[model samples]
Target chain A: MARTILTALVSAAVMGVGSYAASAATLDDVKAKGFVQCGVNTGLAGFAAPNASGDWSGFDVDYCKAIAAAVFGDATKVKYTPLSAKERFPALQSGEVDVLARNTTWSINRDTALGFNFRPVNYYDGQGFMVRKELDVKSALELSGAAVCVQTGTTTELNLADYFKANNLQYNPVVFEKLEEVNAAYDAGRCDVYTTDQSGLYSLRLTLSKPDDHIVLPEIISKEPLAPAVRQGDDQWFDIVSWVHYALVQAEEFGVTQANVEEMKKSANPDVQRFLGVEADSKIGTDLGLTNEWAVNIVKAVGNYGEVFDRNIGAGSPLKIERGLNALWNKGGLQYAPPVR
Target chain B: MAIGVTNVPERSKSSGSIINDPQVRGIFYQAITIIILAALIYWIVDNTVDNLRRANIASGYDFLRSRAGFDVGQSLISFTSDSTYGRALLVGFINTLLVAITGIITATIIGFLVGIGRLSHNWIIAKLSLAYVEVFRNIPPLLVIFFWYSGVLSILPQARDALALPFDIFLSNRGVAFPRPVAGEGAEYTLLAFIIAIAASVFFTRYARQRQLATGERLPVLWTVLGLIIGLPLITFLVTGAPIGFDVPVAGKFNLTGGSVVGPEFMSLFLALSFYTAAFIAEIVRAGIRGVSKGQTEAAHALGIRPSLTTRLVVVPQAMRIIIPPLTSQYLNLTKNSSLAVAIGYADLVAVGGTILNQTGQSIEVVSIWLIVYLSLSLATSLFMNWYNARMALVER
Candidate 1:
């Protein structure tokens, strides 16, 4: 007993000393490491999963790359850490990753209590239900006594219960820990309905044995504004990341395509010139501890937001999600950037 | 007496002093350790607080009482997006328990059958069991879950074209819908009858055992107990007007409209955990049977015991002595592995805690709760197993 006490005391002392030394800014340490460790999902097709050649591509993936471009001027300067929903926040809290660009929802508690800051909404989604077409279910209200297969540990679960309860309907929930299981349960007739963010439903539907057999309910029960998140405390890093996203929006607004970025550098318009580093007097990039051409570099590396979305989850892609809410402000969507000047 | 005196000065020594005096060094080392530990703990706590404060994040469990504005995919109890964080977590805990219990029961039955098969005289049975164990054991549990869920389950028929199974069960790509029991007014009387029957059966079992010991004759206690347990409740049901019915599932235009539905998350986790843990349990069972010496069975046979009796009376009891300890570990492992429910969204403890943590940002509190719950579960299980093992152990003369 005495020996055990002694060992415990010794270890406690060591930990105390160790933690004291580790209280410094982790952002600085990340900068020195030359790569931002970004946590992402395993495989959501267009979210963070690997392609055929194991290269990460998607709107979420580009967000991380854009941050890398802004910080180091090299889009490839990032290490991707694949995390499950349970592991995502813990990874960020433990300093295992610098940024989480996965399709995580932005909520008040996460922002205030979890010590994380959601930069901006990248995808606007809502909780929706999908059922087999043979059931001919047209609305969520029709799922009175349905067995709903839902992924656990998500906003979708709450939305499901709320929707049912509000309608005075009873349902059984078949909960899975992962999206794949929910998909499986729905497919195997283990559940009567599968519900999640509509985008996720579309992604899942594509992999179904008979894709045309299922139909998503027309009603979107809950709003799910998905965004990238970064650990709080480093104001400078937060600004850099938040504005990296803003830069994308700003680039799109100023008609700065990757193909025309060079030509636009010599434009007569001062806002366009200032954005492309042709006229560096605005000092926007320098204020964030970066060069005036940071936005230019980001666009050159990953293109604008629309390009990234189109290549990933848009109509041109397999997921084929329309840019209804994710379109630019001028295009009648929620994406708006604070002017760079 | 003739030895030369080499020491010039004698050091001061206590009367009770010895070379290996534990009091002297033990106290000294313990004090040093305590001081070091105290310092370390203080530093870590200080660092955490400073870090959180610097990051402008509050660290506490107070957020658990806040409204959990998010939704859960599945819950046994009623929950809403406007529910408290505490309620959300409760739902998650229930989901975890559901999966763990179901997995444990199924895994045990499968493991026993496969274990017996592994020892069968028939080469085919033994080989099949071996192959089952090897294939499942070699693969990761997560992959197995995925394979069952996405690879197989997702490809089934749609809800409208559900493949009807026996007993009004419907199977479709969406999920299986089945008849659910509806308890009526006389159900209370039936439950009471069941309890009474169970008590009577226990008493009779003791009496039968005593009678057998005295007369050297065995009574069919198993059949008697079964009859008492089932017959009494069933008779009460008939006498009370049979107040039990099932709500059968019905097909609708878009989905199955009425019936009880078991979701895919439970199915995949249940299947995966059972198959994965069965491999380990099978190994334990095989070792247990092997541990029983051949002489014990031979002795029983020589005493005119039938082959079945010899196996049961001689081999099984002895095998159980070796099996219980490892079996307990397997049970604990299955319970812990149930935490993998996060992978398939089964709302197990870990997954629920994760949701709460994400919503509340109470990392310290959430992690503490997790550690405490899991550790206590581990301790409780081990304690129960130890007690059981002691009961089954060989008694010395």
Candidate 2:
């Protein structure tokens, strides 16, 4: 028994030493594996969730597929890890995921202290309050001495308190850790008001027993610029993900739909030709350590930004969210991309 | 010494050397284990440091003092967006304790009744108890929480049309609202009288036990204790001019206008934990009662003791000896399961700690705090239970 135990100890010590010497940046590992592990929110409609057919289809899920197309010529090479709000950052930090495509806000502390670099905002949202219309409350200011339901571990909770304190309102907060609980409390009449991002409010309202009874107050309390994030210390990986999102916006601006992407390769326009992977020697894809057909693959797999948004969250979908801040630059919204070249 | 050895009888000896001795082997094994444990810990620490550096993330607990810039849903103490992360964690700890304590109490009462019902002579009662245990024990706690929060609670009436219960209590899909106490100036005197009544009850219980042992006559101990607990407090309240009033909730145009409200997050978690844990507790209780030999009951009956007296005086005391150890462990399990509060967003320790971790980027610190707090709580509970068990142990002549 003693001899067996000694042998086991020595072998374990050797394995530990070997692993310590072999540790490297997860970005390189993900690149070599030809896939990016993306952490996403679990079952948020239009954000990230599976459909009835067990296939994931959402705005956030598209970002993950786009990154995979950028790295490899196949969008299906990516693995999606559905994580809770509390699990997203930890999964990224522990190297369990290569990128986080969940609808995370870009905050100063999260950027500098958490060792993450966020790309441009994909969704511009604001915290808002929703109350049952039976109360005849048209504005949030009337919610003095009210009981408000807010989700825990979110910016919504902070905004609710700030809005109340600034208005000198004395209110009690009915807090829950998950969005479902907040909605439940609101539906149950445990709270007179429910507060969250406007997009989330729309999605949650649809799940209520009487959707038309609740009215979203006419106030945008806080700026919520939802963006995609990648880990720090991997400039190569960061550039790849950033450019992938930019490509989608650029595609929309140049009128390169998935139906016309094949025909656009023969166009005389230099910018369209380059973005279509047919001009300027196709150097953009090569520079990012991918094949020249990368852009073609992404568009074919997921379509342009407008296509993704309209199908998932726009008027055509259940959420029916308007493209107020997410439209293209020429359309008078904040979404604009630099030249592909 | 050598001269005497020549005259001694020779003994049969094995070929074992001192280095190959069992005692030596045991020591050697212990030394190896210690060395391996130390080396493994060193390697993990080294790897973590290198990884953190490569990721460019700083690791420390200094972030606890940083501004939280976040707010919690339910807090017993005052907090703000500008409160420190430490304060947020304190709020989380209090929330966890509140849910755990309430869950344990409710689970115990339900579990004991169901356990006794399973051993009933009637076939229907036993079958019903069996069905209850099977249904709850088969389902996961998370699903149960969702079932209650969304499936049931969300279907309740609207705030304006709340279902009114007795004593000015209101129920709706949102949660239950109840009348809160409004203490008056003379409340202290009434509280003092209640405490005095409890002391009198304890004294009367001891006196009743001694009277039954010496004179072989029984006293109505239950009635006396009840009167001391309730009647004395009532008299004291009248003498003090009724020192309390109710803050009854009034229905407003939009919502309930006054009194206190309990959120559905807490209600769902409390309900789920109690029902789920009671299933396991019921099984433990049934086994405990069954573990007592049947001969003890028959012997008590042969001594001319009534059936009810045999159960109260002989059967129950013996079954408790078997029940308590397992019962204590079940209570601990319920406390730990309360951490699932993160799922339904009840602001328990794990959920609150998770938020602080995100705001500060201090994963190691936050996880360490969780481990230390939970482990210490477990240890303290175990120690207390051990002491109680020793006091209740049978003493032999």
Candidate 1 residue-wise lDDT, B1-397, digit = tens: 3344454333334435664565567888999999999997787677666666655567677777887765565678987667888887788778877877788788889998999899999999999999999999999998898787675454777677789999999987556789998999979999999999999999999999999989988889999999999999999999999999999988775467666877666787889999999998898889999999999988888899999988788898889899999999988898888887776666677777776765455666676677777788778889998999999899888
DockQ class, candidate 2:
acceptable
Q: Which 10 residues in a row give candidate 1 chain B its minimum summed lDDT? A: B6-15
lDDT of 1: 0.78
Highest TM-score model number? 2
TM-score of 1: 0.82
Model 1: CA > 4 A from native: A1-30, A44-49, A120-143, A146-152, A167-226, A280-282, A304-335, B1-42, B66-84, B87-95, B98-139, B143-156, B171-177, B212-220, B253-259, B297-309
Comparing only chain B with the true structure, the TM-scores of all models are 0.90, 0.91
lDDT tens digits, residue span B1-397, model 2: 9999898654323435767666677899999999999987998676666666655677777777877777676788888877888888999999989988899899988898889999999999999999989999999988888887776565778777889999999987656889999999899888888899999999999999999999989999999999999998899899889979999999875567678877677898999999998998899889988988999999999999999999888887778788889988987888888888877667788888877765566776777798788888778778887887777666566
The estimated TM-scores of all candidates read 0.82, 0.87
Could you tell me the lDDT of residue B211 within candidate 2?
97
Q: Evaluated with DockQ, which candidate comes out highest?
A: 2
Candidate 2 regions off by >4 Å? A1-28, A145-149, A170-192, A203-214, A271-282, A315-320, B1-15, B78-82, B150-155, B203-224
List model 1 lDDT by residue over A139-164, tens digit each.
88878767677765566776777777
Question: CA lDDT of A234 in candidate 2?
Answer: 72
